[model samples]
Target: MAKAFASQGDLAEKKVSFTEVGRDLWAFTAEGDPNTGVIIGDDSVMVVDAQATPRLAGKVIENIRTVTDKPIKHVVLSHYHAVRVLGASAYGASEIVMSEKARSMVAERGQEDWDSEFGRFPRLFQGHESIPGLTWPTLTFNDRLTLYLGKRRVDLMFLGRAHTAGDIVAHVPDENVMFTGDIVEYHSACYCGDGHFTDWPATLEAIRCFDLAAIAPGRGDALVGEKLVNEALDNTADFVRSTYRPVARVAQGGGSLKEAWDACRTVCDPKFSNYAIYEHCLPFNVARAYDESLGIDTPRIWTAERDLQMWEALQG
Candidate 1:
């Protein structure tokens, strides 16, 4: 029998943790679930990556209130994904920020993506009705947007295309801390549904310039200290390469999609099987890798229908 599509069957709630990674920086990580980075400036706060729904964002907000009552002045989106941006309303942030490219993507398919992801991860979208339509960025920049939290500075940079074309990282120069969206995952599976396999490695190389002391990735536990941070970076890079290389080879060899998925699984599952969302992300990741290997540079939009079709094809 075919399994449930995407994470719809993943009903188990994860335990949430609000850990202080730096002076005023906090990582709200829920086991292997999606994470939120909080940066408390002198006056206000900046939230990186809102949760999937208003209800979920409320939980993050409650955590934020525990440490500081500062208004969430800015909500920065690392990339344009329904699971990440739909919670903007909950923060009531003055400025919702993201890359211009991400804004374009939101304009292009934000509705479809919202529908697609909500269906895929029903657990994440518990209060689906509370979402007040699609989230729009009030402020968008091309490459970098520097936010001044009094004397401190948080530079939002678009290193290159990896997880998505508009993927960006928030770097705290003074602390040498980074809030890397999905560009760097720890134990969690890197969702490559919209990933750029070729450009990702180069993007990973750029992250080393920060000489990070700590990193809050999109998922998994926060990486503390230089060594662990680098290791997580390397692991994320490996996951990307391992998922792509085999699928690319199979596609170039004119292998079937099932064969390509099998090749990807043989490599990824051995190392990443126990990781969070490995099963849910595998089919979509493999499908995108297969397309990219066939010289398709642009990632096709993922709709609920396409998601199911691909899942059935690969799961069979």
Candidate 2:
């Protein structure tokens, strides 16, 4: 490989921020790292997107403790990414939730994703040894499922495929706040290696239709108020579209993967170079865009070996 993954060199710990995005709802963000959402109902708490390891999850739990003593009874996984679901056990929630498609993906490529992510971003999986295994959901719903944390209705809906085939969003009806797992992002780059580029914009529009007041996104800081929420949504859509267009144009021209990479950079760099994880996500995003442009509907599973091979090929 010409160079290690961008995440491999990111060893410095990020400053953690636990901000209240809505009444009784909190967002645990670590600079640009993966974020966790907390929804406190009358009797219990529901968490969204568990961290990558049990140790990292402990931080979210610690923050949750500061505000509410209610037990975390439900842990909702937005998708099957190892970075988001592997830390589920740490929550000790009796009901671990995921969309039905997400659970199926776990059955198909969970281990490969675990190995691939661990190899690419060692810093995120600091306590890998503590992860019991591939995290599986104890509960799942196909389109939508409603859960009440003692009268606080929480709706989990599969809006559409964006970040992954099974991406879902948690909406708190009372507050009109949504915990959008990777379906929406703030300033951070979207990790689209397993994404659906063609379907992504529509998914964003679906979320937009909700006109959410606040959003605890998959990554980046919590977006509060309608203005901020809209800004994030628009920016995310722009990011997704910006990334795909150039790469698709290159691939449609029968260009090499390296050529597609360069093409994507030419367009995305000037606009998104300062975004968090921009460098880390660019290659994978370009590769997926290239594949999708060629009419590949399903994203090929990324394994550790494939990550290295793709990196080397792009470097060439």
Candidate 3:
């Protein structure tokens, strides 16, 4: 019998966590699921990443209301993934900020990604109907954009291309807190389907240059203290290297895609097998690594059909 396509079978509800990472920074994590960063300023709040759907985001809003009645002033995206940005409408923030490149990716393949991801992971879309449509950024920045939440200053920096062409990190200078969307995952697998392998390490280096007291990653528990924070960054860097290096080597040798996939798994699985989404992401990650190793810089659209085709071809 054929295997189920991608993450279709991963419908179990994950345990959610809301923990304080900084003075007023909160991380909403779901057992290695996609996380939401909460930054409370003097007068208002800033949400780092929107959840999957409006109903999902409502839960985050409920938590935000617990501490502060202050309105959420801005919603910032770390990258252009549908699971991260589609629930943006629920925030009602004055500005939805994203990197200019992310906005372009959304325009090019947002609808297709929505369709593809909703099918792959149903738990994140419990209230899929509540999503208004594709989320568009009302404000976009080329390299960096700075915003002040009263006294606190938030710097959104595009630390080169890693997870996507438009990956940005939100750095809170005073508190030494950085919300690195998908660019840095703790124990969770780095979802590299839309990633830039060769550029990821350089981006990670740029992130390391910051003196981070705490890090709220896209998934996994909030990393606090210098030791754990360094571990998370190192782990993320290791994951990207483990997959891309083996796959790139295979691709460079003119090996088949299946060979690239197997070679990558051989190198990565021993260490990352237990990470969240490891199995679901292997095919797409390997596919991207193979193409990028061959010089395909711009990512190809991943439709539901292509997702299943690649999954079957690699894992069947």
Candidate 4:
């Protein structure tokens, strides 16, 4: 291979930050690693997006203890990705919640994604053996589900698809703060391997329509205040559009996948070269963009073997 595959070379631990985005709402961010949201209510607590493994999730629990000793009654999965859902058991929450489509994706491609991601990013899955099989939601909802942690209200809604087919967001109406799971990244690369390019912008617009005061994004720092939130939204939309347009143009014109990759790099690198995980996400993003342009609506399942095959073809 031309370079270390994905984030295998990134072994150094990142500086973890627990920032309060809104009243009693905390965001656990580790540089550009996947983030977890903590919503403390009048009684119990609700967690969003469990980390990659039990050991990693323990860190979030430790942070949670610093603030309030309230029990974590619910764990909400933003999507069905292994990195986001495998650490669910660590929470020990009575109710594990996910959108119906997300649970279906788990039934469809969960293990394959687990194998693929564990191989791609070893740093994220520090305690892989502790994952205790695939994480399944005890509770599933179709479009929207409202849960109350005492007086605090959390609205978990499926606001179209962007990063994945079953992507969802947790909105706290009282705080005007949203915990957007991979849907809105802040200065971080969007993992579009399972994404829908055409549907991404519209999904982003739907979040924008809310005019949120704060957002705990899937990765990077927590976005507090309306201006920072809007910036992240605009930048994320730009990243998705920029990656897709050039690759789509190349593919529609009968260009090779390599050609499409080069075209996407030309457009995306200058603008997003400094973004977190930019390199790790590029080839897959380009390949998916090519496939989407060729009229593939659903993203192809990524297995460990397929990841290597695609990486060798693009990076070798």
**Candidate that beats the other on lDDT, 2 or 4, i.e. the better one:** 4
- Against the unseen true structure, what C-alpha lDDT does each candidate score? 0.93, 0.92, 0.91, 0.95
User: Could you tell me every candidate's TM-score relative to the true structure?
Assistant: 0.98, 0.98, 0.98, 0.99
Question: Could you tell me the TM-score of candidate 2?
Answer: 0.98
Per-residue lDDT, model 2, residue 184, is 89
**lDDT (Cα, tens digit) per residue for candidate 3, span 212-265:** 899999989999988988899899999999999999899999999999998998
Error of 3 at 302 (Å): 0.6
Off by over 4 Å in 1: none
* lDDT, candidate 1, 26-63, per-residue tens: 99999888899999999989999999999999999999
Q: Model 3 compared with the native: what TM-score?
A: 0.98
Output the TM-score of candidate 4.
Answer: 0.99
Pairs with steric clashes in candidate 3: none
Model 3 lDDT, full chain set? 0.91
Cα lDDT of model 4 by residue, 273-300, tens digit:
8999998999899989999999999999
RMSD of 1: 0.9
**Pick by lDDT: which candidate is best?**
4
Backbone clash tally for model 1? 0
